[model samples]
Target: MILETFKHFPDFELLDSGNGYRLERWGAYRLARPDPQAIWEHQLADAEWKKADAIFNSKWQVKTSVSQPWPIRFPLPLKAGEAKTGEWSIKLLARLSTFKHTGIFAEQAANWEWLTEQVQNTEFKAQKEQLKILNLFGYTGAATILLAKLGCFVTHVDASKPAITWAKENQIANNLPNDSIRWILDDAAKFVKRELKRGAKYDGILMDPPAFGHAPSGRTWKFAEDFPRLLADCTELLSTNAKFLLVNAYATNSSAIALQNLLEDSIKKTGTLESGELCLKQNSGRLISTGIFGRWSK
Candidate 1:
């Protein structure tokens, strides 16, 4: 499996990288933010960083338009703080704007294209048979929407109400069939346990486990301590003719080798395993390893 490859991102650019930070352009917004992973030194002038529309402090927020009256301090709501608006179009009720994000991990684009092809080519002989796919930790539902667009009956699970709501808004914005997907706001592990108890099975499963996060009710999810058990239980939830299982990790504790080892120990025992790191090419044409991904297929 290829861990890092040169992939083209038509709409995004990694403008600069240095000082434990990165300058990025998404659609029409230019942002400067802290990226612990970007350890390189800046090759550009200081003026370049000053030109960002927004800069991150302890957290993220919008920068006042240079032409507008500058407020002494900007007080933004939590959700608003994490978002940035640009001229770009999005699939959510939230106005079509460049998001606070640098464009959805640009590296995951490869996975998106791969999965779409997989679902499109794999056929089930049963009449009225539909591919049952599940996406855990589905942040904004980009993959969920994409899979649904390809005729999969997707169940998208996330613990954050706003995130789920955002995903739903994106689905609606895209005019997706209301019946094509199911949105659930619950702890992913807990939901999987319940699904197992209910004897539910999925043909395909995708998960992007966060390095550290908490559920709505304060349930902590520390990937290192929990992922193994989670993966073990998830294997039980796969159907007899399961198509694929994908796991993506971005935390420092979760390396490409570690993820591959876990998949080999867990899913490989049941089927074939494929794994690698996901990477992005900066504007300077440098490859940046962003995340790790693994897959198992029967």
Candidate 2:
């Protein structure tokens, strides 16, 4: 299992947590957000609360048009049907109003760093082709941007138009290579199946499948029921010298060991395996176990 001991934007501190809320400072904005896992009491200076630029309330919108009743100062990067409007900037929008999710998951920072490292550390000069990466369930393309920044050719796949647009924005925001990623709007499993039939292959694969979701074609997906088969199918799409395969899961009772075992069982005929939980450190000096991650490599 790979352990993430460091991270980007140490500038953002999760200063405290309590009563289903967290106090955090992202850049200059001190804000409060709901964290169901944060069941403890809040213990921070009163000054922190007073300095917040915004507090994301329970109300949100998921539409082609975004209208905020409050004075919305912060940028919302991932919305339902928003188009990419700016270059080198984070664009946020709400696609689902059930929670405060803007469609981008912050816990993915660890996976982004991991994929970038794999791309950079590979022996590219000795290889016959450029490193090719496939980011399945690639919402907003954060991982796509990181891999592209590391000089990998990435195929970013997602079923949402807004997500693909936001990912394009992030790529521009980081000034990444324009042609580095091939964006696709499709169901991940079906796409992989087609890629295999076409004899396509990739050096690195990153997936953060939702617990449950539907495609543009109205196809339903349940991770627990579909993941094992998906992993098995993905094995056929890996290059003979593939570097890594990463699977990330959240809000599921599935344990890290369970993810590890599944990957091991599915890919044992092909490569080596490593798997575990990915976590973040909150400001209260506590670890927030965010999700399960599994990896396989030649």
Candidate 3:
């Protein structure tokens, strides 16, 4: 499996990881949080770690006074050979969650760049001016905005109302076209079933599911029990000329290879398939592996 790390990143930094916690710098503020993957001795001094603006140990321990939601910008430079050559900026809001999340998964920056390329360099771009995308579990709308800014109409679905609200805030903050994104707050599996019945099609489909999730309709999502059937249904929703499918999983017992295997069994279209771990690099040159992903593209 390949190990992918973010490049051209300055809005976020992984300063250190050790003692089951990670010290990070998000734009202007610094934060420290629990990291299960950092099972080694710390490279930075404890005093340095203690100076975090916000620390989360079971609950947030605030130190320095900070804004309720701060702005962080991600610069996504297009790769060579794309129709567009300049970089695009993705602006998002950063807020500490009760569950120790900052509303941004910086490690997925690599995949975001790949998504940019797929949009700008698609063989179907000439035939299809606006590539349609379905983003399930679309937290905070980072990828959603990226695709929309590149002239794609995106349907962003998430179970959390607050997440969808936050994502909408980010969209307005960036001054994007209001018609570019369609926001849906519902259970991913149930929504997908409805889309399939309506004979809806998407050029690309992406999801980043939590280990367990609860929907507004009182439906619960268990990855192990619900993911396989969801994947099968997602494949059927893909257009015959689909461009890509991406799946991201965190805090799961399953491996990236397992995701690849499931996609192999689920996808009927022949395409290039790859699976790997997504990681962040610390200042000390060590990598903190965060999650795994399986991506397929034509």
Candidate 4:
């Protein structure tokens, strides 16, 4: 039972969490957001929780104590700095969203680190083969930018125009090359089908599908009904030398074992499969489960 948790994120922290709410620090700003998994009692004092610059209320409204849309910088790994000044960084625009999201998932930082290591390994680099990565539902482009920065060609697909635009902005904010990523705004399933038809392939594939969503054209995406089909289609797009496939689901009724079964059934490839909960360690030393994930790698 490997619990994938992000404890090394320099720009993010789970300061405190309890009482169906969480207090976190994203870069320099503190925010309070709802988390149904924090079903325990608050460990931090009321004064500490009040230190948040903004709080998302039950009505999906943000109550801010300061002006929003601030800037945050995340320190990147050494591999990501090789192309830069030996100290790579990523800039993000943080604001309170209606969905209680801060434009980034800190827990996925662990996955980013894992992906970087996989592509940077000596064996992979010795092959001198440029890796191609596909990122489905790549909101805000965090992983896409990191992969592109690592010299891999990335295809970033998202159904929301605003999310795609935000991801592009993050790319520019980090000064990533314009051609490093190919941005696609379309339904995930439709795009996969198109790629399969064109005989396209990728070395790595990542997806974080919502429990329920609607495409830009109002096409419904119900996880229970669509995920199996999507995974099967994605398997067809994998390159012969495919290195990895990662699936992440948040706040869904599906379990990590379910995701593992889905991948095991669809990929039909020999690889190491690891499945577990993605959690955030609160200041109380308690792990707050946020999502479930299944990762396959060679």
Candidate 5:
């Protein structure tokens, strides 16, 4: 809560943007993808844009046959340990999908970092056991792997089977213990309700819900209608000392203020509440706002 409102994934870069597209460098590959935020004129030359390894116009266009999966590693703060040279890190498997995603949301890198910081600070010396964290709408598990690496036991819930499988691969990629993460392939709201019924509680909870989607069981999740109900359910599921709760949204009508208000209204606990836009800083020192986020922590 004491850092910049805008942050980005150090491993990724937004190279240029314009014409409803953004050119990005993910690890070593350059990609051009459609972005609603790129409403201005092109900042880079066409020649420069021609170097993209892949360009998406409803699909990928590349010069050569592309690999299936690649690694994008984020260095972690070195833990208290014996080795000096070896640093802790986690890697997300990157792949070009039909939906034009590389299996990770680059903008969420900040929230992942912030969540870790909040948990670390809140845990203090009082809590010794591994914290139980719930990750709803857990996509490819970037935060899941990162947090689990810090020794948290995470329950990752998502409706998509493919997403859960990819997240499992990411877990293995990090070499985390098998019991570190509980992979649950179920609708997020339904799963949360079940957890509430089971009297389950979490030390922390984080969710990145879609603007609109359908659960695997064909239940609809409309941001305007469902988010508040989900938040109410989540409030009851948190541990009393709940170390953290993060909500990221890309809904059309949301702002940081709106997110803050929602969080403030949902939970009765007293904690630090911070909200801001999720943004990507381009090489030219410009920031492209992607989504809004609000987080609470003890």
Candidate 6:
């Protein structure tokens, strides 16, 4: 029952959450977005909620006069030279969308931090083996960028062309090397299958699958029906010296324990499996569960 919470992101903050919505700050812009999990009463005063620069109403309508595509910065994995302690920037479009998302999932900071530590471990560095990572369903490339910054060769896959484009834009905004990541616009399951057929292997794998989605080719993906098959195929793509496998699910009926069980049963490898809810800590000290995730590490 490990609950992973992300509270150290300087550029992001959960100011308040309640009544099926969350108030958050991304850089200097404040936004209010829908969150069914924020069912409790809000602690912040009305005036505080009113200070939002924009609010997403039902039907994905945004009510505000805020500017579009604002920039936000976050600390990157430590690197060499004066830029070692420097931060990375990304552009955010605070507009209402079909998914009611604002490009970034702040709750994933916990996973990003964990992935970075895993890559930077002394043992990993001592081995002098360059790690290759595959990121499936990598929307906007947050984790992809972080992994690439750690010197890992990354292959990022997504089903939406727009998502891949936006992710590339983020890469450029962060000033990452043009060749830092290989972008693939295809269905996650199909892409994994093709990689398996090609005998391609990766040192690490990360997937964040939606409950229900449509592939670029119009193929439908239902989590309950496709996740098991996808996991089986993905296990075959893991190198013998694999370092980690991470899976995240949002708005799904499955529990963290279920995710852990599935990974244990499908991976066919001995390792440590941990699962829990990914949460965001509000200023009121309350944790708003955003999703469930499971990770396996050697």
Q: Ranking by TM-score, best first?
A: 3, 5, 4, 6, 2, 1
For residues 101-181, could you state the per-residue lDDT of candidate 1 as single tens digits? Answer: 532455676777667656755656235688999899998787887778666899999998877776787787667889999
Residue-level error in angstroms, candidate 2, position 262: 0.5
By TM-score, is 1 or 2 better? 2
Ranking 2 against 6 by TM-score, winner? 6
The TM-scores of all predictions, comma-separated, are 0.81, 0.82, 0.94, 0.93, 0.93, 0.92
Positional deviation of 174 in candidate 6, in angstroms? Answer: 1.4
Alpha-carbon shift of residue 157 in model 6 (angstroms): 0.6
TM-score, model 5 to reference: 0.93
lDDT of 1: 0.72
In candidate 2 the C-alpha lDDT for residue 172 amounts to 65
Q: Scored by CA lDDT, what does every candidate get?
A: 0.72, 0.70, 0.89, 0.85, 0.85, 0.83
**Given candidate 3, what's the lDDT at residue 183?**
98
1 versus 6: better lDDT goes to: 6
Q: Looking at candidate 3, what is the lDDT of residue 83? A: 59
Candidate 1 local lDDT, residue 183? 91
- On TM-score, the stronger of 3 and 6 is 3
- Deviation in Å, model 6, residue 262 alpha carbon: 0.7
Question: What's the CA RMSD for each of the models?
Answer: 8.6, 7.5, 2.0, 2.2, 2.2, 2.4
The worst-scoring run of ten residues by lDDT in candidate 4 lies at: 58-67
Write down the lDDT that model 6 would get: 0.83
Task: Name the lDDT of candidate 3.
Answer: 0.89
Candidate 4 TM-score, C-alpha based: 0.93
lDDT, candidate 2, 42-131, per-residue tens: 677767665555555675322222333211112223223436555323323323233665444655666766665566557773565689
Q: Model 4, range 1-298, lDDT digits (tens) per residue?
A: 5788864677888899889999998877788899887788899899999778778885434445545667776666675335555557667777677678878888888788888777775355667777999999999888898888778889999999999998998888778888889999999999999999999999999999999988989999999999999999998898888899999998778999899888888888897988999888876688888799998888
**For model 3, what is the error of residue 96's alpha carbon versus the real structure, in angstroms, after optimal superposition?**
2.1
lDDT of 1 at 135: 95
- The best candidate by TM-score is 3
